[model samples]
Target chain A: MNNIALGRYLPLNTIINKMDPRSKILILLVMMITVFLPAGFIGYVPILIFIATALYFSKLKLTYALRALKPMIWMFIFLLVINVLVMRTGTLLISWGWFKVYSDAFSQTAYIIIRLTLMIILCTVLTATTKPLDLTLGIEKLLKPFEKIGLPAHVIAMMISIALRFIPTLIDETNRIMNAQASRGVDLENGTMTEKIRAVLSLIVPLFVSAFDRADQLADAMEARGYDPSATRTRYKVLKMTNVDYFAMAFALVVFATDLVLCWI
Target chain B: MEAIELEHLSFSYDGQTDVLKDISLTIPKGSYTAIVGHNGSGKSTLAKLIIGLLEPKSGTIKVLGQTLTDHNLKAVRDHVGIVFQNPDNQFIGSTVADDIAFGLENHCVPTKDMQRIIEESAAKVSMSDYLNAEPTNLSGGQKQRVAIAGILAMSPEIIIFDESTSMLDPQGKASVNEQIRKLNEAKNITILSITHDMEEAAQASNVVVLDQGTIAAIGTPADVFQNDALMSRLRLDLPFGLKAAKAFQAHGIEIDAVMNNAQLVEALCQLK
Candidate 1:
């Protein structure tokens, strides 16, 4: 119960929570572009500021954003070291028989790591601020225009939304089935590679069978309601572009433009 | 005037012998009908046939004046909803809200209206608070509520309960039965229940006993349960009270009893 309570959507009642998901996604896209735009410290400082500001406005904790970046910390450090020490473009600080470090290496490493950290945190902020269902709806609305290009945007978004909803459910089911199998003497989390594989296969069979049975019942329910997949559908909450949305987009665009100017200068 | 009419229905799966053989039955409109039989009595098969989930080899089903056929199966299906036996089998959505919305979404209900309907349906089954709660997290009783919510969302004219309450504990079964009874009164949805519980069968307005896919007995539950010889051959557990009363009668004790334990006590006390 506590595990469910923790993972369940907070349903935060705030301005950020109410904003159109499409707008949030568009803002996230702009932030992704910002990461690639910064050329030096001048351009980078503003982006770091922008990320902080966005995080604040979204009412998401900075620590939660930072926590999400922990797993990738190792990769970030690896890339920083590789990019700074191996690329010989500036004056050398030290030269050994096989390895050399440039004078600008420290600053370059710092900048790269910061950018990588900011990118991960920024992305996490967007997701944590928005519900998966809302984000899916937002994506659908944003991609509505792309239907002209032969993209089944609605279908894709529905798939994504439903997929997200199923993730926790699947996890819960896998856990339940694991418990049932464990009671029957299946050791899933330990053993040799082959033994583990066998355990997992045994677990998967019952899960799939249950899933199939659910599908058939769902299909029955669908047919019983005159459900037609290839039909026009309406949304539950109408997504509208608001003033906050424009403000968000503008903030992202300004960072991108500043980054471009710094690169040129 | 029958609400559901089945004629000479026969069924077999994968070149096997007939699971249901030459079955004919009629369920009157607004009637609470129970189909009872022991395991392998083919009662569940009839439940599937009525909803058009399985096609018959040689038979026809008429639901609400519309013939159950491939061409109109969609419309027929829309008017007839079914709650299956296994609570787990009927749940397709991760959450109760999502599950209820699954049916409405399929029918292309506007999202705003769909949400309201989903909420109302969940409330009808006393699952409104757990609307966004995951189905896997629910108890057996709670999952059944979600399943009922899904059926309610469809607003079908007829609802078939295919041994839905068998998996529940007694308390859970009683609660679900209460809800079903209330819904039949408030919504007027025709209910065709397939059950082996003698108590449940006793409560229904009509009872059908299936033996080898044929209609062995069909009447008010009280009307059909009086025959013990047939129930024995079908492998059904005899209703305890009825058997007790019969036992007393065999011992030369004249006793009158109804379905209640209290009534049985009074009748037994009157025994000299």
Candidate 2:
């Protein structure tokens, strides 16, 4: 269950962790665009190096970062296999009846796997170091300019962060409710497919009720504290860019620029 | 100065039986008032009404001298904060610092001073070290403290505890009580604690007992506790000392006006 590692922040003293969340978000965006733009493998060398260095500096264990990719490992493998079987070009490596594997296919598959893995790892690195609320504030700061166009940047950022925060909480709650139901002699496992589905269906109503109840109380609490969604509220944890942020942003820009040049070549 | 005043306040959920019927109450500034009642006695509804979460059908609520209306409710809310029941549910922010900064942000506190106020409020609850800690990761009492920190950071002149400690263990409740005592004493913040806990009611400067959506009794705890018939009618237990004195009285021994166990014990010793 912890393998998702979605909202879990690994507490470690590292330079990457010390960088401002806005800088990290910017770095993440640039890295994502750069890694995803190029079709060739040569461009990903910098991203791989960057991710490896970031993982080392983050003080987070390699296994934990890998765990964040666990849920998508199957998807990555499936896509890699599909690409290998579907694309046939360059030199033929193997042929059996209707199935044929090619050198070009292998390389393309490898490139995609590396790109996907790198993207997931980069995201893991971001979430693992920065707290969820900081990410929200960072996103809100980044989205502040859109407020002129009738966008509720603060509200949108808050919604995203709240969803992120509640993922683990709601998972724990689901487990609790399942355990409670199980204690009452409800067979959740070792049943027919329909029975299992029914058991799972039983969970949705309670979970919905609890979620709505929480939402209602939260609204009341927010209102009691004078929250006005349309008001122009000052941010308490404002995202400030300092020297380290500048250095990180510059480093990211260089990586992105290099990736662009490599793609042109 | 009146911290809060409710005049002729009546409310109902289904527009049927009035949950709160013509309730008139006044809490002076810097006073600790406890509203106690059994479950579904409308004490919580009254807390909601006072906080402007629920509007009464036929009366007015005033906080810090401003009457609460649809237009001015937000302004009044700035001066009054509420820590609700269900510690997990009331937390709107993910972390301790973020939650405290929430109200501050609403009040448009400058970013430069937000950290100081957040830290100061956390320190009031002795939770300064857990600024980055998630609300879910905290204990029930710690979460409640963080919620209180969120409210206190706004410097609300009046803070309402809507059965905030009902879900806490005895130790947690005691810690929250200690923090509340400090707030009332040091900051001169008015407290309106809605609870059914007899021990908490006994400790407050004034107690208002609600029964079936009406004020059954309102006075100093000593004065209110003296009305055993009303207390019994509301299905509220007397504090241990008072219960013991009553038991002794049933056995032909008289221990009158004993507010606590120590007093009852001394009176028994003197009689012997």
Best prediction by DockQ = 2
Off-target runs (Cα >4 Å) in candidate 1 are: A1-9, A80-86, A102-112, A189-191, B88-101, B108-123, B128-138, B240-254, B260-272
Q: In model 2, what is the error at residue A246, expressed in angstroms?
A: 2.7
Clashing pairs in 2: none
Model 1 / residue B165 / CA error / Å: 1.8
Best by lDDT: 2
Model 2 preserves the real interface contacts to a fraction of 0.83
Best by TM-score: 2
Tens digits of lDDT, candidate 2, A51-144:
8778888887778777766677788778778877788787988899888888887787777777777887888899889977788888888888
Per-residue C-alpha lDDT of model 1 across residues B1-272, encoded as one tens digit per residue: 56799888789876579999988888888788888877887888787788777888887888888888888877777778888777765665556787787777766678768888988898899998998787557887888878888888878878888888999988878888877788778888888888867777666788888877678888865566666676667666656677787787788878764554556787777767
DockQ agreement of candidate 1 with the native complex: 0.39
- Which residue pairs of candidate 1 clash? A227-B106, A227-B107
| lDDT of residue B46 for candidate 1 | 82
